[model samples]
Target: MDTSDYNNACFAGISSLFATLLAEESQSEDCLYLNVTTPTYRGSWEKLPVMVWIHGGAWVTGSGGGLYDPKHLVNQGDVVVVTINYRLGVFGFGWHQALNNTEGGTLKGNYAIRDMVQSLEWVRDNITEFGGDRDNVTIFGESAGGWSVCNLLAIPNAAGLFDKAIIQSGGCPAMTEAEAQNVMDGVVTDLQCTGTDAEIRSCLQGASVEDLQLAATGDAPAGVNLNMASVVDGQLLPDHPLEVIESGQHNAAEVILGTNDEEIPAPIFIGVNSSAAYDDILASVFPSPVDRESLRQHYDLWQYGSYSNATAHLQTDLYFRCQSRRLAGALTASQAQDVYLYEFNLPVSTVPTTHGLDLLYLFANPTPLLPLSYDLHRDMLERWTSFARNGRPSGQWWEPTWHPYQTGNHARYRLGNILGMEYPHDDTGCDILDSLPNYRYMGEPNDWFMTRVTPLIGLLDWVLDTIFPSE
Candidate 1:
């Protein structure tokens, strides 16, 4: 039996309330690190392919190498896996006009994205010693991590760092300079640090992490959502992700991107108890009377049987499914390289197929929670590793011929109890949702969808327990 070692070094995590709930160890501001997992190897010239993982906590919370045990992926796939930690919340993504002025108004904000690129640079320089093929690297992530991978594709400096990417349930969204400055101004006001540019810079540096965290998240008006996201600073990130991809300026060549059958389920729905509540949310999301009517008609209550389910499905389409398709379309139009799409339709008893559920079968952690079928587990590992090894995600004894996602095609591999290619199941609603001008990516100004969903992030803990009952 070949031996494998999974190194998950604990580092200071992001200082946010969400981080507090998710962290088992103490969290501080000084949190930039990464973990590498490798399998046993002999003294040979051949090295294994590498896959770097970026964890997801909505850009504010979450660290690498804690819950994601890559031992099984390393050993079974015979590859090296690297998990990384980047700054979160204000420390990582907070931006101010004064800070930019202090530094001569260069690319400001998006420290988290820069940290991720730095990790890739580390892998390029040092992964050879760990028996990995740095040139044959594939970067993959879920949620924010997936979002990071998508944003990294748009970053000019991140070019040639990795060869392939797999983005799971992440949208490609970026904020304009004005939006980012507004968010930072609010934080500065909360901290009571209004004065000269020098004084503001000093205040930001001297403030405690706790105070920063509270200032970042506290006392916001009822409708305002405090989120840390990538900024279109015109230097680091040259343009919006969609614009970059369409202009053939993106860094990715081979990609596998998709979402779960139901990325946001009813449990996180929280307050939508009736049809009226659902309509109210729709009005808020699509302020235009015509757009709201189109959506309401598309997600009518009779079809879904209840507003709770309708709202949940509508959100899944708007935030995850449709956005993912938009990214895939952009990739297909820009490059000839393979772009595969998928939908994790596998449903567990008493559980809705939600975000991050596909990970359980991919990593196949041997902790003995929900025992997935051997066929399903094997299929996921082979498909993912196959993509990492070669650009194509085919070539297994028991596997069917998988197709690359193509432009004008509405087909994606359905990863469920019965796996095969299928048509876009929610196209009607996505059609209406995508038509809305404000539904551009995720970080657009005045986007209320994130405001509605951020509170429900805490409920993800319950979703985790429901999936892994042993937790």
Candidate 2:
């Protein structure tokens, strides 16, 4: 939307970044466009590693074109960075009885995820022309984008598309099949459509796109609006992502998984109208008794007279921390690939490391309004670019080297007024997650609690070390 803000940061040898439109016509038919940033127009030299970013918007909103500005990553990382736009909302993931009777009926739901897979397939085919290494590509995203990365790792067709991944603030503990189907049935009832898959498909195909959009976002009988989200369609997605990861049945791409210390505060930037509604939503989603008391105690002990920050604590733990740990553990169990875990503990005053705060650093912007935030951004660029160059981030203070996430010695990057490492042990937040209902894996459950859970707990040790330095 705002291209002018990106003109100066472009580097030499880096040609004009452009968006190309692609389309597929068939059962898996949809728009397949991608925005690419490259160092040169020719495909003569050896292929450069590629970074494909998937935007985050609950799988309902957000366009890859809207979320990224290629100036920094393209020029600095020296790699082709492609941001993609996929189908969203109902057009992306609604399921109906009408489609069930058609060929490949088992692939009814999960259209959005299919679009993502298709986008990757396009990259695998076309990135070579943009001076990109087709054989060495990394997929990264935040929030729903992170969820999409996890989904990509699980999809059988997406195996060789990426060599590495970085997921921030999302995980595989997404909606279950029964839960998703219940939402689907409710949507059908709300639309007053014939229950048959074929009839529903025909009716939807003929309906106005606006009408479909409204129906998808509208409140349904289940009290949860069913929009564009991946489903357990027996074909595209045969099982939950966690199931696949735990069973070691996923792609063998190396992974970097972590979350912000405070992820919930970002929504406040959208508007305050939904504060009460969101509070209820948080309560419903992360109902806690065991962890709540322990968290309260920890807060009181650590930041005495800081009870107001409790809300930020609860929100981050529920939406970011817990889910991140679950995903890391599941991937670690795969043991088929490398998994690196991290936690961004850059505290902004009373707010714990809020959501999207990490974006400032990752993007490496030069905005003057947030200077302290920008310095950290520079450090992030150095580390991340180093990783892009050699699969490992480099820096004097923030180098990412610790025991693997399963060694009970989790390493976190503490980026705030300064950047350094902090190992939090005795936190036991993942154990609290394990105590919850439906938290256990159904297929080949991995004993992640014993292996990877303590590394996160080690964070408490880091926090303590910071408070009482022996020097």
Candidate 3:
């Protein structure tokens, strides 16, 4: 029952960042606890399907508690829901040659991901005691959590811990050794450790959690601020997630994956006020002039009304939507598992269908400020729990039977005002994004955010405040 906060990195602003900040004062480094809820009405001898939730915060912030209520999924869906917490930021994802496996320490990175594997181990061993079917476990998460689920699939130790996965806005990518070392170099310089590897390891070990957190914060030596992501440590994670899946070594047999229609909010495009500004930003990200023109042609300014809006669409596709489709295709192509894809297009509020909005309905926690349809909540819960109960999300009760996302039709379910099937999803934009030589599924041009968006911080401050006014 020790649910004290895990010492996570400090973050600010609205959305999950606000919640992460509010818990900063009380967050404990000893926060690896999980909560399980099972239907009480179920027969005592019957074991319900289990669903494990991993919260998302770009791999830096977020926990598996609070706002993630599972009562509806437990009671109505007749399933067992478990939400677990893990270490984040530097304490969880820091990497240094001094702590490498070759140097006699564990992988020393991917600590957060390993923490998840451990939690799943606990579930596999003891979930049956809580009226959960250990063999029928499902791991589901959004954003970073979704990313974590994909990582778990690649880990040899995590194989067979879960049978199904639901990845919402999760992409398959991992930091290479060099990329991870870049982050570690920043930590070493920030900690002022000047010596041999052993001494540096000692110095890092002696540093306070607070100091490490500060060292990993923005403008730290890494130049890749908040670069807290899983690393391919050659042990726990042998290769990039997509590569592992493509090689037919992944563990997931059935999966449900998709992303929000608009993964990037307007506030993120603060500096792209004019078409010229947008073009400048594009020119910097895309190497070739022809590719930039093709990008512009694909996302026409006239169609989007404003440059900022156009930027939102382009980034959303590049980062979330189209990337998810690629992962879905990989899952199907590898072993041809039953993969169900979705797009949360419901405009539940004044804002566009931005990231993490589906959680409100998925968790059945509606807010008066942005009231969502109860029917939509029911639909989401049923679809998820049904998928957990069986490999398919389409139950006998469901109308217009949801089909698996095959490579041919690109069929996917649309969870919006009208919940039904959508066929042959158009992804002409992804073709353009794939053509970008600089872009890889794994984060490349590693200093991308620092080079492109860091300069826009001053301009985005007012926009963020306007959109999410402080209380």
Candidate 4:
């Protein structure tokens, strides 16, 4: 196995810092390594909180090394931060019956998730040597990383690995098992292998890393049915995250979940300029008559009516905001754990409260920022570090009590130039998601439906201001 190293500079000003690598047994033949970071070396073990971070790349493009730099958190919060690299793209997640046969059904799909669980087990056994507390652990991540955190919360085998969790920009309604299989099939075809399960498995095993990556990069045609994601394998993921949450079957851990205000604008704006293109995308994503009717009523499609921008906003709400709300709501309803919900509203000069913008603030790295970003980072760091330390974010002057999101009173922290609290309402968006067919794979444009239904859903939020008037 290959390995890498970082010097004392990795901890710079932090006292007692160490790093190491460990190999863990995996259900899959591949994916058996994990990397660890800690605050010190010790003779006898002392308990320290551990933060196990999972990287995000839509279950595909990211590595544990990409956005993790543990020096700040380790020194400031007095916690151990472990970042593990898992199999990515086709190698990590692709599914085929032949591979299942090879593993004797012990491992079906979701090898990446299994790898993560193994990594946690390794930490539980060995973290004591590195001055970490095996008993206190927090699993956290952003984007697909957050999605992985949600998966862990629901996985039976992953229950005791962590005590708290922070999921940023990913949540329930992520991806289904069938959707993941469709993605795997597309990758297999792109590799030009025979459609048979055995031949496809052989081709994947023989292909180089670069070859697999290239095959995964092409764009989906306009009307193509597509499914790309981490499968809900019964062994690793018993049910959809939402189902698990609703059933109160998730791990008993405190949670912090949030999303950027404008999550999908850039991607949507790039491809959709005309109303026709916007409608095309919407029609494809939300082809259900009931969903379409809900959208019409909720959005007042007559006003602020351009479907293009509306589509972009709708996609953002569906993928980020709505999902975040659902996850938070589920956890709050559990009555067994603490949950916090927030919306990142800090507007960047080039990016408007967009995806990945919160990274700079959360990481607290110096970057060019507008006046608002500067102040927001300071406040955010104070709150976030406070949360990491005591499961409560401390605010200056007045410590804001983060109330759990509930049926009528959804207390969500609105983080922005002016930091405050508010209850979000986008009735149309909620209605569409609630009424849309349950887990239908094809026929009506579900993908486009997400894009079209979101903005109109947001318009319904206008009612929130009137109903619950801000102080």
Q: TM-score of each candidate?
A: 0.89, 0.76, 0.89, 0.79
Model 2 TM-score, all chains together = 0.76
**Candidate 4: segments with Cα more than 4 A from true spot:** 1-35, 39-46, 173-179, 195-200, 218-226, 270-275, 299-305, 347-351, 368-374, 425-428, 437-471
Query: Which runs in model 3 stand beyond 4 Å of their true positions?
Result: 1-25, 101-103, 220-224, 347-350, 395-398, 444-456, 460-471
Two-way TM-score contest, 1 vs 4, winner: 1
Q: Is candidate 3 or candidate 4 better by lDDT?
A: 3
Q: Write the per-residue lDDT of candidate 3 for residues 1-471, one digit (tens) a residue.
A: 344433332332113334344454346666777888777688456788999999887676667767677888898889999998877777777777877644557556777888899999999999989888999999999987898888888899998899999999877658888988887788789789878888888898898765666577644222224476788878888888888998888896799999988888766776688777877777656767888899898787677877777887887887777778778888888876798999897645465888888888888555566658877787788889999988788644746688888777778898888788888546678778777755656553233332245235644545655775533
lDDT of 3 at 406: 78
Among residues 3 or more apart in sequence or in different chains, the pairs in candidate 3 whose N, CA or C atoms overlap within 3 Å are 5-28, 7-28
lDDT per residue as tens, model 2, 164-211: 888988766345555555555655665677746667767667765445
Worst 10 residues of 3 by lDDT: 6-15
Which stretch of 10 consecutive residues in model 1 shows the poorest summed lDDT? Answer: 5-14
Predict model 2's lDDT versus the native. Answer: 0.60
The predicted structure with the larger TM-score, 2 or 3, is 3
Residues 1-471 of candidate 4 have per-residue lDDT tens digits of: 345552111100000110111111212324345567665442235566777878765555445653567655666555678887666545566666667766466878777777889989999999887777788778888887887888788889997888888889876534555666565666677778785667777888897554555455433222111234556667777877667777888887888888988887644444455656555555665666566556656543364455555665677766677778767777888747778888887654455777777777766555664334656766776666566656776677774555665656667887886577787564456546655655321211224335323333334434533553322
Model 1: clashing residue pairs? none
Query: How does each model score on lDDT?
Result: 0.76, 0.60, 0.76, 0.63
